[model samples]
Target: MKRKYIVGLHILFWTLLITNNVINSIAATRAHNTVIDSAVIFKDIMLVAGYNSIMILCFYGSYFLVSPALFLRKNYLKALLMTAVLLFLMTGWRYLLEFWFFKPVLGFDNYKGNNVSVSYYVSNIFWYYFPKYFVYGLLYFSAENWIRNRNRQEALQREKLSTELAFLRSQINPHFLFNTINDIYSLTYQKSDEAPVALLKLSKILRYMLYEGARDKVPLHHEVEYLNDLVELQRIGSKGLANISFEIEGYVGGQEVAPLLFVAFVENAFKHGVLNDPDKPVCIQLKASNQQVEFSVSNSTVVSGTQKDQTSGIGLSNIKRRLELIYPGKHELIISEQERYSVYLKIQLGS
Candidate 1:
């Protein structure tokens, strides 16, 4: 798409340039002959078309012909030297063909009569044709500049995305650690015999975080194991009757997904849903198939006059941006809040 847009822009620019030059040529002839019209303009454009053909031919062909050798030699100076030589030859040929062949064929009246000399030809040829080469050179330089800036912009975007992703990943690991440590602290304070079991579960989660989750993507099985471990921590923290339920309905198969993609949803549920009150409970369902994965977390929260303080929504927002970058049109996210808050996210892999 980008390349097509650039090409379209270049074509538009050259079309305008050629149209302007045609108008100027006809206007110049009209100044002296007083017999210019659309026919004259068309004729002048046709006369220049022969040289323009050479300009385009050399512009595209000669560069490609020498580019391989230039790259092989790994010498920029030599490559530039070759380019200069090719330009000179092409310019000289264009000048020769236009003056010696095209001018006479078009019945152009030279102010100096039929006789042509080095000085006369040079004055006529250089003045008339040099500007065409200047136009070509300008076009080349502008195109190169456009390409350079485009590459620089793409590089910056990639680096920015990488940095943001790393920061998001960093936040995720520590967030999970904070929650796990809180659970461990509760277990220790209560002097519960399940402290050893909680420690073991923490160790497993930490091992996955250290090894598997650090990667760009992790196996489906590994992520499920981590999710189960997280649910176990929630159960332990809930003291066996917290009314929190997590269910996975479908097989994940052997597919891989981006690490920690499910963490934000789970964390939000645990943070807001796991209340000490027996009247309210959290319901979370996660399901995956070959084509899609869906997560739904809904919880009951009462409307109150007190201010509901929430931290920066960066974690969930980062997940949103990652979905945009990685899945784009293949994902859907719906967030609804009322007496009950719910988040539904579905990603279509096969789409």
Candidate 2:
């Protein structure tokens, strides 16, 4: 993808190709093959190199111009026509180079005293050289398109995932603030001592969502702090009735994670989870060790009739796409849904 590397590879490929041509040139000069003079042999190799150089024009013209600008752009007819025009010019130029320089240097007198003719041009271009150059152009065009298409697909996939991540913020609806205010209002009339703690938790959650959670990376401890505050906020609203448990195990001292990466899973669990169930409560667990992190969240599902999240698939899909983009081969996600919906995620942390 880097320009230097692309150039280096081009140099390397052409170097090998020219080296092979030189070796073959030497082999063709063997006495058993022909008793040609050294100067004539040299002239022949120059002819070969001249023709090869013109073929490279075909290579570049098709790869850079015709293929991308026309072929891959879906102008199939135009691409073919342009390729034919380029081949005519390139092969004709190579013919001129041969007739004027290489043929005279080798003492070939077929066109002596400028007696060049249409029959000779047709014989060399149409019968001898056109097929070889056409195949060369096709090879370069096909190879270039193949590689470029693959790169474009991967880039588009990443772009789509990034757009999904940015869109995910919309899912964090405004209802939380409205409900929290009402909960505070009720608590204030009763003079409940938990109201102030709830407000503090609310402030922490908002501050992280607006500031730290919007950053590219946050200290792992900061994410854990946010998670703790989020769980506490949910518990406060439930008034000791939701039965949510949160725990952290192993070392989490010097790591950093993508901001808000795990928030969707927790939020989905609370939004779709059956909070009033006594036997099946929401459980969230996280562990970090040996340069790896594991997180698992499971919650009971409400009955189909009462479950409100009938069209809430985008959040889970968003997390899956984010995991693919950010962690790539370094993470795995497992989802299970029968009675209780559960998600298990394992990621190798970047230092």
Candidate 3:
């Protein structure tokens, strides 16, 4: 909680207390059906103010001094001893103010009889003012502590989320880089002219990854352009043998999405799915609207005699964790591996 908000709550609490006192005084005066004298009302208000000023001091003394110094440390004996001292001091202070100052200078006294004794005055102060204000001070302290702890917890949670997201992004960048580098290496080994073109495309993609990918979100069009460049780079490396279809529906320019959110699925498709078969080419589709974004990637499953790729699931697992952290309940992800390997993702964009 901010200091200003705490101060505001203090002001509100005192305002209500003073208002209640004033209202009760007025109600008592009305019950007697007497004409309200302005001087008497002023005197009553002044007395109420004087008494409440003592209460304010007592409240803060417990809140800022006694409670932290003793009560919070579980020094109950010393806390009780200190509280007893405080109660007597405050009672004596009010007694002097009412008797020596207000009664003499302002012509009024809270205690009206000549038979008043020290014991009665002390009892009145202890039962009426001390318990009420002291309890209020302790309660306020507890509430403030609770608010501070909750805010700290929330801040720590945000920091943890940021760190985890950064780690996931680190994995994503290297994974994509490794795959793209291998494709380029294949071109270089074959002595193809398209290797230079692929290198140039790779440079642009790297720029986007280093700059835009570091951001939490980017314009949807920018992400779409990145995907286009990546697909083109892969095509160049394939020497026109790879068959891939990329499609976009609805307006993509007006929205924003998490950067590199869909790259893992695309990379997984290209890595494990048939790329040369025209009848079963890699298919990637993205549809966007004001309220949601839908993305899917599907490819024909390759039939190889070799065992499943041990490293193939890394990108998919990284993306799944990222989605859980970033979207939580706001996104849905579905993966199917029957006739074709397919991944579908839907994200709700509304706040």
Candidate 4:
């Protein structure tokens, strides 16, 4: 997650390791109940710290460099060859440090005054401590490789999810503009007095639509105003023959909703519900509160050859999938048909 968190964990790991090493050093010094001077204790710690520094550096090389470049990159043959070379060199390095450097320069080796042969020291380095060092290096390498793979998988998942979401949201634009543009054309072709007004209304709606389409959410007043303008656009050139009504029961001052989320239902109402009905009004109601928003649309079902079937349109299914993806468990949708057709939607907008 956060860089600081990962750094903190590394710090904690190093702290615990240093603490354990210090405890073991202290236990060994006191094993024979021998009184030790501060000077001797400090020198003992210096020698132990030097060895610890070397091993930590070795482990990290395996963790950060070799694992990714070889082991994780699937160069198994190269990884094995490199590892063998490293171990051979480290064995020689350890023998020189303990027999030559520690005994002469630091005077910290256990057999410092003894006449032990060079082969004896080499045997302890290669046979006794080499396996432990090799195992520790492998542990570090495997742990880092696992973290790398996990992070890669998570990044890929997020990218895929966002790409699909963008495609789904883009589908809304064409489906919506197609119907609105048709309504505007009908007014202009009739040479109706409302043609210019409907065109102007369409322009305003498009201004909002073009800007807000890319956004994840839009404010309450913007959506409410768009819905109102949409109804008025459909009402153009109607001459009071087709009845239509829109109602709002609560304030839309601070609410927010996904862009173009409510339009498909409105468009479907006009298309398949009341387009040919002169006396029956397509009723739309929206109620918004601090925590929730609800919308219901009802109209007389059209039984004309020109009317599109509501159940057979692309708009309904697209919006249904959109709602499921965007709101999931936060929304409820209901559709009923017997005489009049109606669709109701309710959403919990968490504050």
Candidate 5:
């Protein structure tokens, strides 16, 4: 993944701000003294620097540690009381340090020796420290809110994409089923003997598609079961109607595959091959392993007439789009023809 540029920039900005302020303070200290090196200036402010660093980090750390638990437990009143007490204690601590140690050592006795009114100290504390603390607190809460909103938006977008893909897959499956059922309806009307066997096979295919195939994924064993049912349906229906053969090779353990992903090519074979002529043969071969599945279907077609017939076809196009969406760069598909036309697909399931 690429680095987060904004986070790096934020760290860099804070470093520069801290360094610039420290250097400026040291320069001011050096202006009035003869022993005005970086070392002397650091020694003069060392105690102040140490105390400020510890106090500032302590305040920020404590606020973050408590705020989430306080909000989650719905203890706003307790949180507010604790915060107020902390601020009061911090104010007293700063005053004590200034009066007892810093004033004597740093020559800040003008503010301490003169009985500066209570109002003077109160104003200095409120104006100088309150805004700084409030702004830091505000930024912390704002970042949390921004992160939550971005997550929510991303979730909504994923749900939308999933819905659209499901609809597209639905369109392909239903169209194939409806056409085959209509063909069965015509055969049953003529009192054909193969009608009962065809109906039983169709019921099995429908049951699997409506139940198992509706899921996000199904076991490879279930996919093989559905394919067997589909081929049986085609075989029985095409006995005197057309010549067709379906084949499968290789072991498929308990791996999973997206439902109806391989069915489109099967449906296309019948559409383009079965109705053309009883003399013409349609052949489909499937080879599967733990890591890959290879499927190929071949059918002869009259190019001009078939092209016109395919104008409203959604089977092949829908399958291609669904593969792109689900597998992305993990799958390959090639469709072409020689003296014998064919559709070939190879998919690699992630390990």
Candidate 6:
């Protein structure tokens, strides 16, 4: 916590304490139905202020010194000894001020009786002061400690989240690059005219991955453009044999989404699903609104068992983990694998 904030809390606590004491003293005087005397009220205020000053000294002595040095370090015997010493000094100081200073100067005494002994005075002071002031000091120390610990935990959680996100993003970039490179290699081996265009598209994709993809979020349309480039690159590599349909249904201009969030699903479709079937081509759709975003990808599955197992690989798992960490309960993901392998994701935007 900030120093100013801690100081403010202390000031507020003391202000409330002094106000309550003054009000209660005035209320007691009014209850007597006697004429309100300004001299008596002033004397009461002076006594309250004088005693409270001693309490403040005792409170901070424990707060900054005894509690941290002895109690916090688990030196129970030493802490008890130190506390007793503090109480003794505070009680003695108050006794002298009341007996020698206030009684003579203002003709006011907190305790009145010729029979009051030394032991009774010390015990009375201990019971009154120790229970209130010392406990308050300990409570204040405990609260500050709790706040410090909670702040530390939150900071650590943020760092862990950032590191995990970066690791997942690293996995995504290379996975897509590996698949794209394979497609380019196929075209280069055949000396296809589309190889140069594919290389240009690859450069654009790399630029996005290196720059935009590294960010926590990017404009929704920027992600859409990245997906478009991926689809076009796949089309060029397949020599018009790849049947893929990509569409957008709502306004994405004002929306911002986590970068590269939808790429895993698209890559999964192209990797494990049938790409050449015109009757059931890879279908990608994204719908957006002011409050939410919905994205879905579906493709015809292969007949082989190996391909079916490959459908649920690192890419899908990585994206699932990312969604859980980033959005948690704000996102819904559904994967259906009966006739067609499909992944649908919906994310709630804003607070």
Report the number of the highest-TM-score candidate. Answer: 2
lDDT of 5 by residue, 51-111 (tens): 4543464346335644543543457776676566655665666666667766666555535
Q: Pick the candidate with the highest lDDT.
A: 6
Tens digits of lDDT, candidate 4, 1-351: 688997799778877887788768877888865887786677667667667655665566455545655655577777767666665555666666667777777777676567776577556655655467556767867876678667755654564465444433342344445655776687678887877887888788777766765566788778888889877766653444557889999878767887776776776777667655657789999999988999998889933323333443435665666676666568999877757788889988862
Cα lDDT over the full model 3: 0.76
Cα lDDT listed for each candidate? 0.65, 0.71, 0.76, 0.69, 0.64, 0.77
lDDT of 3 by residue, 39-96 (tens): 7677667777778878887898678766765644577787787787777788788878
Which lDDT tens digits does candidate 2 get at residues 118-187? 6676556655554675566567777766786677668656665565445444435345456667887788
- The whole-model C-alpha lDDT of candidate 6 against the native structure comes to 0.77
How would you order the candidates by lDDT, starting with the best? 6, 3, 2, 4, 1, 5
Prediction RMSDs, each to the true structure: 13.2, 16.4, 18.1, 18.6, 15.0, 17.7
In model 6, the worst 10-residue window by lDDT is 303-312
- Clashes in predicted model 1: 0
Model 6 scores a TM of 0.49
Clashing residue pairs, candidate 3?
none
Quote each prediction's TM-score: 0.51, 0.54, 0.48, 0.46, 0.47, 0.49
Better of 4 and 5 by TM-score: 5
Question: lDDT: which is higher, 1 or 3?
Answer: 3
Q: Report the number of clashing residue pairs per model.
A: 0, 0, 0, 0, 0, 0
Per-residue lDDT for 110-222 in model 6, tens only? 66646567788678767887788888888888887777667755754674566544534453345446667887888889998877888988888878877786676788989
lDDT of 2 at 274: 80
